[model samples]
Target: MATYKLDCNGGSGNSYKLALYLNCAGLDWQPIGVDFAGGQTRDPDWRAGTNTMGEVPVLEVNGQRMSQSGAILIWLAETTGKFAPAGTVERFEALRWILFDNHKFTNNYAMHRFQVSLTAEPVHPAILSFLRSRAEASCAIVDKHLMDRPFVLGERPTIVDFSMAGYMYYPAEETGFDIETDFPALHAWRQRLAGLPGWKPPYELMPVGSSPPVRVVTQTA
Candidate 1:
């Protein structure tokens, strides 16, 4: 049995991405909580000692530490020989969708949700509106893509599904968008992912609360 430790907080969709994969794959792992709500990642010492990039969802296993959710997901699939995109064509296809997810699908939505539900101070309504619109546009593309496929690649679930489904499980009140009614295809896709073995919602697996954020999201100077 391989032991895996993931550094994370309950409120992080990025962290949840890895958590979801580990659970669904039936791996032996536990979440190592990071005090993200307390400016822990912002500290230079913590960054130097843990992750130089200063982010959570650090996967520690067999004396190796890995960051970046996308990279780690690929590594896990490769090492375990599970969910490793069927072939060359599917691999490229997975890469394309994962890039889109990181750049827009997850990024825009996370920003919008951070501003609306996590920030200590209210964000300007105009900025919020812009982010919301961008998120919606990206969501529309994903919903359309899912309309003809059960998963991103086809009938089978892959890393692309995990990457894109990162924020879909969060509450509408938190994300400010309800896929259940607003994006039927996306909702159905996530429902399918949820039914897989070892699946658990983000907060239920992590040792923290989803509200008020682990810490007020801020840019480091």
Candidate 2:
């Protein structure tokens, strides 16, 4: 079995994506806790030694340090031949969804979750509104797409599913959107993914930032 180490915290859906893929794919992996709330990512030595981008989910595998959840997911899929797109057409299509997910689907919603439920500092109502509106729009698109398909790329689950599922398992309070009622299709889709073997919740896999409502709240000033 190949061993993998990833910088991870429970609060990070980005990290969850990679962790989820590893577990579901039956890979031997370990979570290396990062003090995200303790300013570990901002530390210069940690940055230089691990990931200069100062991001979690820095997967260390085969003597390589990989960053960016999408890229890492793609690399994992290609290397493992598990959860990969079928052909070139599916490959490009999966890329499209992954790109859209990173840019719009998870982007604003993640920031919204942080500001409203995770951080201790006060957030402007206007910012919250903007983020929510953008998030809702992207979410609607995803929900509609999922309405017809079992997964992102038809019947089989792919890396695109893992990518899009980054923030899906978060609580309604944290994400501020009750997916069960708000997006029926997406909620059902989340359930389907959860039913897969070797699946576990974020906090179960990485407990670095498990507590809610700030979890100490030292960052994001």
Candidate 3:
């Protein structure tokens, strides 16, 4: 049996964060696809049993459940001693970037992608504009931060890279942002991280076609 079991939705960048890290680290893990569009995660039973927050990337290790990609990444880094911060300052920097990623980076980016590509209904133009602005802001900050660095922590890959890279690997159409064109520095950083040994794309690390199609309900008068 694998040492870890990850329950996640293929389209979820949060899930991809953990899944990608596990794959690149060459950990013994299994993927359990979640049905996000089918309301599987929203089910009371699931919420109470798996994750009280009703979120994806719920990792089960040694029969213990863990949630939140940031927390899990920290734990994994500490436990495995790979992709870990070198010392005190690096550790603090890593924590800062991870928090920034969760707050402003992946948070806005994933929300914008959901509105633009994942949702069946058309989102309001104003909402789309708001999301886009926030996402762009995060991108600009990270791009500038990585302008002269090889990785999030100056030299080597770390958990912060995994956190920030969660949504970057998805198709341009889905994300509606051409990082390679608009943000060259960020794009280069992504490529550098992708070159890590044992690295795999999101879909390859976890099943990507698990979410059920959105169904439309008709009302009879």
What global local distance difference test value does model 3 have?
0.86
User: Model 1, range 95-214, lDDT digits (tens) per residue?
Assistant: 888899999999988888888778877778788889889998999999999999899999899888888878888876677777888889999999999999988898897865223643
Please identify which of the two predictions, 1 or 3, would achieve the higher TM-score against the true structure: 3
Model 2 steric clash pairs: none
Please report, in order, the local distance difference test score of every candidate based on alpha carbons. Answer: 0.84, 0.86, 0.86
TM-score of 1: 0.93
Model 1 spans with C-alpha error above 4 angstroms? 209-221
> TM per model?
0.93, 0.93, 0.94
Q: Model 1 Cα RMSD, Å?
A: 4.2
**What lDDT tens digits, residue by residue, belong to model 2 across residues 1-221?**
34898888898999999999999999999888888878888899999999999988799988989999999999999999989999899999999999999999988778777777776665777887787888889989999999999999999899999998888898775677888998999999999999999899888877764334443322222
| Superposition TM-score, candidate 3 onto the true structure | 0.94
Candidate 2 ranges beyond 4 A from true positions: 209-221
Query: Candidate 3, 62: how far from true, in Å?
Result: 1.0
Worst 10 residues of 3 by lDDT: 212-221
